[model samples]
Target: MRFATYRHDGSTRAGVVDGDVVHALPAGTTVLDLVRAGLPAAVEAGTAALAEPEVPLADVTLLPPLQAPTVRDFVAFEEHVEGVRKAIDGVAGVPPEWYQAPTFYFTNPYALVGAHDDVAVPPNSQRFDFELEVAVVVGRDGASLSPEQAREHVFGYTVLNDWSARDLQAREMRVSLGPAKGKDSATTLGPWLVTADELEPYRDDEGFLALDMRVSVNGTEVGQDLLSNMGWPFEELISYASRGTEVRAGDVLGSGTSGNGGCLAELWGTRGEAAPPPLQPGDVVEMTVEGIGTIRNRVVAGVDLPPVAPARARPRTRKRPAAS
Candidate 1:
């Protein structure tokens, strides 16, 4: 079943999405509430909601399916890693340690926006880009879980756009530290969330989902790939994420960017100067994952801030200490 959080009649409500319509859940309920209540509960609520009044999907405003407690994005596509690395650092291949385990970085959950929202280009950024990927929402709390155990914690999936400021990212990563400000600006999630059970037909025997993934800019196709192409399956990424830590209900895990031309940086790496230019104001980006749904967002100019002050160097306070 597909679940969505939407606004109607000056109020936001959670609901089960039926074709062209949405069945509202009880008042004040949100998708996050359903996720925390567990999938069986969500199924039961959705079943009961089928009798409630149906609202036209087009009449309501969609919101992010849920406000995640935390967001962890992983680079699980080898082609994406290779292409982006080459563009950013002129590196020709993936780092050796990248294969040892699934790796991820924390992104700001508060930065999340809903499907069809407007995203502002980060201030001072000239090279804006979008990453096409799929994300999983954690439904059960677990720590130190093995791949087999992690499967039970899966809740559902959604399309994710990890918007980027390539120029800013390039500068920060040069110091070997961040994709911070470059990424923290905004992340797009939703249209709606599709339950894990709903995607059973797409799952392969090896636990990978053979779902088609695609992205476009301003109605022009930019890239496409299969979810099955991921170097590490979602289960393994979840298992690795739970290592010595905890993954709880409402936490979101992203599958990084898809392969092929997932982002302009990848195209830039392979096509050099001929690659499409970075996103600009008024550009629209759309990302879709089979079995989930599509999320479309438009770029807008950002609020420009005064120039940032450079860090001041501190005086050397420590003497030679008697040449010890």
Candidate 2:
């Protein structure tokens, strides 16, 4: 079943999505509440909501399915890493450690926007881009879970757009510390969340979801890739994430950017002069993952803040006394 958080008549509420109609869940209930309730309960509640009055999907404004407790984005696609590494680090191949285990980084949860929200080009950024990804929401809490055990913790999936400011990212990563401020602007999630069970038919024998993913800008197609191409499946990513750490309900795990032109950065690495231009104000970005849904966001101009004070000059070293 598909679950969504939407605003209708000036009030925001959770609902069960059925084609173009949405059936409201009880008031005050959010998608996060349903995720924390566990799958069976969530399903039961959704089933009950289906009997209530229907609201046209177009009449309500969609919101991010849930406000995640934490967001961990993984580089699960080898092709993405290959292309991006070349462009960002001037490297040629995927790092060996990336194959040793699934690697991820934490992004700000407060920076999230709804599927159709407006995203501003982060202040001081000129090269803005969007990453096409699929994200899974955790249904329960677990720590140090094995791959087999992690499967049970998945609640659902949704489309994610990890918006980026390449210029900012490049400068910060020079210090080997962050993609911070670079990615601190906006991360889009939703349209709605599709429950895990509903996607059983799409899962392959090896546990990878054979989903088609695509991204377009201003109605022009930018890239497309298959979810099955991921170097590490969602289960493994989740398992690796739980290594000595807890993954709680509503925590989201993203399947990085897909390869075969997932984002402009990767395209620039592979296509150089032919790569499309970076996102600009008024540009619309739309991303879709086969079993989940699509998320569309528009870019807007950002207000620049005053420049921060530069770092202090290094202190002069004192001359030391000669040792005996």
Candidate 3:
């Protein structure tokens, strides 16, 4: 089943989506709340419509599938990691530890935008880019779960665009910590969340979903990939993340960038940094995953903020002897 959070009559509500119709649930309720309330019961009750009226999908503005409590994005694609490392620092191989376990980073959940929303490019970013990924929403609470255990905890999936400011990212990554301002500006989610059961038919031999993912800039197709290219499946990513930590409902985990040139940075590296210009202001970015639907957004110029000046060195002076 499909679910979405949408605005109707100047207020937002959660509802079940079927084709072009959206059957509204109770007022003041949200999809995130439903996930936190437990998936099976929520699915049963929510699909029943809570005895509320239905609204046409066209009449309501879609929001992110839900407001995530926290977001953990993982790098699960080998080619993407290698390509990005080579693209930025001329590195040739993936890190040794990357092969030992799935790695991830936490991001700003407050900076999320929904489908069709405007994405403002971060200030002073000359290399604004987009990452095509799939995000899984946690449906149950668990700690230190094995991959087998984590599989049952996934509620559904959605398309995620981990918008990036490559220039800022490079500067911070040089410190060996991780990205900050470079990634905090915005991350896009949704069109709608498709439940796990809805995708059962697409599962591959190893249980990984084989969805076709394609990205387009303005009217031109930039890249295409398959979710099956992930080196570590979503189950393993979640299990690693939940090791000795709690993963609760409404938390989101991203599948990172797919291998087949899922981002402009990877493409630039593949093509030797030529052609297919980086995203400029007012460029429309559209991403679609075969089973999950599409999310389209326009890049907009960001609002100006006070400039940060470079640190100045102070002159050294001899310290005066302490008074006795």
Candidate 4:
């Protein structure tokens, strides 16, 4: 079952996406709340609640399908590294230990947006790009979990548009603070969240590893890469991420930009060069990870723009040094 958070009638409600239409769910429908209530049982309840007919997806806007109690992203692909190696300082294909451990970040939870919405370009960005990849939504709360038990904690999965502001990202990294301005503004998620049970037919040692996730600007296919191509596997990411930390139900763990070709920065090279494709106001970006779903967002001219300063993560999980 596909789930979503949405807005309609001047109010926000959550719903299950059925086919192309979304059946309105009750308000206060957060993935975390549902997970803590009892994952599989909660999903059963969300499904049962959808029995009462509601508005069609066409009639309402899909907000970020999740209100992740915690939003953490990890660098888990080798393709992305190999692609940007030459451009970045001393960086090249899967730096030795990078694949051995899952690298993660704690991003702003409030700024996340929904699919098909307009992505606001912040005042700080001159170079904006899109990253198409799959992300997992945790279903059960646990810590120190084994790889064998990890699958039980995943409620579903979805596609993500890990938009980037290249210039700001580069600057921040020099200060040993990763993606200060580089990852701000809008992180688009959703269209629908595909449940774990639904994907039983595709499970393997690499799991979703080999599935092709594609992206497009306006209407052309950029390139397609297989999830199996990842340098780090999902199981490794989940198991390692849970160490000494509480990964709650509804927390989203993003598989950082799939491969170098997954985003414009890698595909087009930085500004002083020819852009394979540069995004501007009015351009539409769409990302689709097979079995997960698609995320479509349009670029729009930003307003007066906020300060662009990064927000402090709540409760502040342990902070890792940026230089490592």
TM-score against truth, every candidate:
0.96, 0.96, 0.94, 0.87
Instruction: Identify the runs in model 3 with alpha carbons over 4 angstroms from their true place.
Output: 312-324
Candidate 3, residues 1-324: lDDT per residue as tens digits?
A: 888998889888889887788898777778988888877877896768835677888788888989999999999998898778766666767889888988889999999898889999898888999999999999999999999999999999999999999888888888887888889999999999888888878889987899999999987888898898898888998899899888999899999988776888887776677357778888999999999999999999998877778879967768976899
Put the candidates in TM-score order, highest first: 1, 2, 3, 4
Per-residue accuracy of model 4 over 1-324 as CA lDDT, tens digit each? 777778888888777777777676566666556656765776786788678686777788888877776677887777776665444444544578775677888877877889898987766577778888788888878898877677777777888788877767777787877775678677888876777777666666656556678988888877578877766666667777898876777888888887746887665543335366557889898888777777789999877756656777777669876895
Residue 312, model 3: lDDT of 90
So what's the TM-score on candidate 1? 0.96
- For each predicted model, how many residue pairs clash, with residues at least 3 apart or on different chains? 0, 0, 0, 6
Clashing pairs in 4: 22-57, 79-260, 80-260, 209-227, 209-228, 210-228
Model 4 Cα shift for residue 100 (angstroms): 2.7
Identify the runs in model 4 with alpha carbons over 4 angstroms from their true place: 90-92, 269-272, 304-324
Cα lDDT, all candidates: 0.92, 0.91, 0.88, 0.74
Better of 1 and 4 by TM-score: 1
Better of 1 and 4 by lDDT: 1
Give lDDT tens digits, candidate 1, residues 1-324. 999999999999999999989999999888999999999999999999999999999899899899999999999999999888888777878999888988888999999999999999998898999999899999999999988898899999999999999888998999989889889999999999999999989989888999999998999999999999999889899999999989999899999999898999998887765268999999999888888888999999999987768899988778655764
